[model samples]
Target: MTLDPLPLAQALIRCRSVTPADDGALAVLEAALAPLGFACHRLRFGAVENLFAIRGQGAPHLMFAGHTDVVPAGDAGWSVDPFGGEVRDGRLMGRGATDMKGGVAAWVAAVATVLDRRPGLPGMLSLLITGDEEGPAVDGTVKVLGWLAAQDLVPDCCVVGEPTSKVALGDTIKVGRRGSLNAAITVHGTQGHSAYPQRADNPVHRLVRALAALTAEPLDQGTAFFEPSTLQVTSVDVGNPATNVIPPSATARLNIRFNDRHTEASLTALLRDVLAREAPRHTLEVSCSGESFLTRPGPFVAALERAVQAECGLAPKLDTGGGTSDARFIARHCPVAELGAVGATMHQVDESTPVAELRALARLYARVIEEVQG
Candidate 1:
């Protein structure tokens, strides 16, 4: 029997596996893949759950990676249960229908189709499913990758099933992702009556000057495959309600989305230099999530282009303009690209995917598998 992605997609949607929670999502996957002769291994890192399943062996291994976790369904105004997995008005409705439990279901069904046809295809097929992609990401793909490397199970090429399409299923494939960094700076000053001009130094003034230095100019102009780096001040707080007194300190938070022209170290150094000059007495805390990366266009990318054109009749545009995904983690080990369903409803209320689009994505992934392992 040919595997249909619809039922599996619905089954996955029914699991309330919101970030850091398995909620039996991995069990569902294990049941599906074990029937197809996959060797499934459940890896638990801290409170996070991960799965690694492989079928077949030898050279030219192709791995499909995704996360089962979904962001929380916020305040409820949904027309259906967020975990109901209801099929209504031609859409599969749920929390992860698009980003990206639906994508995972499609790839699994595609693998089933390939196996049924060849049964013993000349190469290997594997999956790296994580439960922490929507969380801190410290315990997910990063840790599994180390295990894969130690076991010598790295693939020749990998495809991360993140929702990459903007307007249509095959319209865009993410070739790279910008790096993300967050910084919090606190400026110290003396607290005193506001009327005393020289008796108190206003930390808020210092904080504003420091931020001005950081945002004074663009990080850089656009690169060949990336847009210019951007920094946004998210918050500034003094928390003082007294109008007559100057606050002792001020804090500001900033987030940066950067491209290949910069690294975390380079950006941090720049930030320190600015703070030192503009706000002489301050403490800064920095957090770097994923560094910028790219997979240069090559045979693997060409094959995906051909597959997408043949399946969807559209030339997929290679892009590097999105928030980071597990592709960043995979990029460190192998050439990886991200292509999946339209992301119109990824993290919003009534997060959903059209039934027709879900099935079409299944066909698209099947074509990718064929082209890569042919």
Candidate 2:
């Protein structure tokens, strides 16, 4: 019997499993995977619920990685309840519909269909689903991968079910992801009357100069499969209400979306150098979400490309552009790629996916499984 993705998708969407909260989402997935012969283990790490379910015990293991967690629905109004999981006019609407619950359901259905056809197929299949992808991410895929590695259960390759498709169902596949870095700079100066300009050191002016220097030029011209690195100043504030006095300090926050051409170390050094040259006395704090990583075009990537072509009829374009996903963590273990539904409204108010696309993605995943196993 073929698993109906729509029902499962709806079931998942209805969970309201906002990040760091399972809200019964993992339970739903466990129930589905159990009947399929998978040995499910619920792994909880630091307030996050994660599951590692596997069916066979052999080589050429293929793991499907995804997060059941969905971002906050926000106060923005919506046509349907964000957790309603309503199927309106052939569209499944909910929080995780496109960002991933739809993809996870489709993959589960694909596995069910495959097992039905070839119950005794060689090799193993596993699902590494996490409930912390939309949150701090410290307790999600990264931790799970470590646990799997400790048990010698790391898959030969992983396919993260992040919504990688841009316009069409199979138009793009993410082979890599750019790195992210955030920094906060605080410039200190003496507070004094604004009228006596010489008596006070205006930190705001120094901060403005530092920001201008940081944003004056492009980070790089980009690489072969990635776009140019970008830096944006997100916030600049003194938070002072007194108009006649200069504040003692000015703080600014900026973020960088960088490519593989740079590492967090190199970028951090560059930033520090920039501050030292421009505003020598300023204090700064830098944090990195993840460094850029690429699997490079190899045998594993080729297999994925062939699988996508065999199933979707369209040759997918290999891309590395996007916000970070679990693929970043998986890249550390083995080659990883992200391929799923067209994410037209991933985090929007009416996040949704068409029924047809969901099934097609399942077929695509099944084909990928076959290729990887071979």
Q: Against the true structure, whose lDDT is highest?
A: 1
98-163, model 2: which lDDT tens digit per residue? 989999999999998888878877899999999999899999899999999999999988988988
Check candidate 2 and list the clashing pairs: none
Give one clash count per candidate, in the order shown: 0, 0
Tell me the whole-model lDDT of each prediction, alpha carbons only: 0.93, 0.90
RMSD of each: 1.5, 1.8
Candidate 1 similarity to native, TM-score = 0.96
lDDT per residue for candidate 1 within 1-374, as digits (tens), equals 37889899889888899989989999999999999889999999999999999988787799999999999999878989999899999999999999889999999999888777878687899999999999999999999999999999999999999989999889999899999999999999989999995999999999999899888899999799999999999999999999999999999999999999999999999999998888888999999999999999998898899889999999999999988898898999999999999999989999999999999998899899989998
Look at candidate 1 and tell me the lDDT of residue 95. 92
Off by over 4 Å in 2: 74-76
